[model samples]
Target: MTITSKGRLTLSVAAFATIAAGACAEPSEELIAAARAEGMLTTIALPHSWCGYGEVIQAFKDKYGIEVNELNPNAGSADELEAVKANRGNTGPQAPDVLDVGLSFGPTAKEQGLLQPYKVSTWDSIPADAKDDEGYWYGDYYGVLGFAVNNDIFPDAPQSFAELKDGQFANSVALQGDPRTGNSVMMAVYAAGIAEGGEPGADALNKGIAFFKELKESGNYVPVNGSAQNIAQGTTPIYFDWDYNLLAMRDKLDGNPPVSVVVPTDAVIAGVYVQAISAHAPHPNAAKLWMEYLYSDEGQLGWLKGYCHPIRFNDMAERGVIPQELLDNLPPAENYARAIFPTLPEQSEAKDAVAANWGSEMGVQ
Candidate 1:
């Protein structure tokens, strides 16, 4: 998916409202009352600090007065899928009501009958390619692959992937998580593959795996998982992660190390995470309400605060609802406008390839 700077990024919020009123029941007071009576929402693998979830969760609870039980804050995308399957038929607190998974996992879960179809009110504002036709899941937010440099650790940061493997950053570079299960690492490898002259679609991951092994052999790949805490503690200084995640770290750190993020010009890949309702959600009403709030203008703005590019960002921008101050901090819209995203089919194929080859090819297992 290629998003251009001017024409495509501007979508009117009024269009969302019109679609919401026409298709859905306008999220009536009865829905809210029912959700409040259900009194609980169970979720899996949503870390608070990632992509404004910290604020988003608190806001939902404060508004609805419902209890939210978040399970396994650090679980990977694959773990999320397993939990949904494992807890089926058990309407207990441990059973997840919703899932926010890597884009590829969304379709796979839907195919296995793990997801239920429920379109949010703002669905019309979302790009067609970013959502499933039947609403089993929809893209929520996205970020480009970029380098998050701890400026204090290396004042002259590596601006490109080539520079990262140039022998100056040996034993320093680290990926956010393991590629075998985590989408972030997988995309990082995919982008690196593009830099190394591989093809555009899922089949190009072989080149990415080879590149990582080369980095590993050069003693440059730090095998440990990367995190904001690791960067702050000086355990992992040169971190390769999503632009939003790294930008949030900078705000969280507040100049402790003065992180500088760079979207590599040589190779770029934008990964989007999708939101879905569990097939057997214990609190189905609450789960639906949560989706309503997430896609609302309020929710979209909340994601933008954490530096994530929300699915309806263009629509909000056109309606002039997005804050000017927030827009100021965002990288030029063109930077993301020109980004390339893999189609759902491409993501599915790539994920399969990674599952089969990542461990043996990159020695990451």
Candidate 2:
């Protein structure tokens, strides 16, 4: 349950290449042929701005010539599970072939018999704690919760959750999504509770609900869900989301309104998202191939480019395959060193608390 950043790891080029070659070996010809014959991969809840998936998806298509049918890009983790259950008998574009959902959702989906097992070639390199031993689901990338601010609206952006409660931030703050279903939003609340001196379990979640209620009472919390366009347009100038998401928004906006991403010193809660193939995937072979690409060195680096710390980050770093420029672009390593990774039980408890009380306690529709 405790996750720590290894900072920067280094190795000589010769040794690095030797290790990287074996770990990132290409998929088998049989798998490729089978996947190509399927011709398409259906994915749900994958937004282009999340985890550098925009370029990652394009790269997959370019490499394998397999068409990717992306379903509702903005659906939440719960929505993804529902999709699998709803499309169990449908062999259409609507049935997701693969899923990338919050870590807590993985076990729930597996328990529901909605996930299939298949480990990637680089499976050995992935941290054991971050993966399912049976290969039903595995961690892809992780990031700490942070704030994304529009500089045009607030020349000096708020740096902490406490700062967000000020009159200056009134009508400016928004969560990435409704905490009732959005994993990121639930974590955002938990992080705020930690900032407010609450512990990591139900206590923190309850405190988080109270914190949001206070913010709402002060007219600082916006009821709208935050997004890239909303942030750029200054409607939701202060958005709470994953650091990678905020950073991606900053890059995509190109400073039209300028944005700042801040990892608050008050509390740093890191969240990991996992990938899995649906049990009744329409394109089974294509789903497996997609998993292969995501866990490969190239796919990992693509996530790094978007500011996510890929689950295999330490493995790749130690192998010296990570480019120096990418390392330099990430937020200071110290920011992550202080991050608190909640256990699965703690996350479930907090999620339940937030889901049950967010609307009633915070009074946000």
Q: Cα-based RMSD of the predictions, in order?
A: 3.6, 2.7
Query: TM-scores of the models, in the given order?
Result: 0.92, 0.94
54-127 in candidate 2: lDDT tens per residue? 99999899989999999999999999999999999899889999999998999999999999999989899899
Please provide, for model 1 over 121-236, each residue's C-alpha lDDT reduced to its tens digit, 9 standing for 90 to 100: 78898989889999999999998989788888888878788888878788788888877788888889888888888876665687777778888999888887778888877777
Pairs in steric clash, model 1: 11-314, 11-315
Q: State the TM-score for model 2.
A: 0.94
The segments of candidate 2 whose C-alpha lies over 4 angstroms from its true place after superposition are: 1-23
Which residue pairs show backbone clashes in model 2?
none
Report the error of model 1 at residue 245, Å.
Answer: 0.7
Please list the residue runs of candidate 1 whose C-alpha ends up more than 4 Å from where it truly belongs after superposition: 1-26
Give the deviation of candidate 1 from the true structure as CA RMSD: 3.6
lDDT of every predicted structure (CA atoms)? 0.82, 0.88
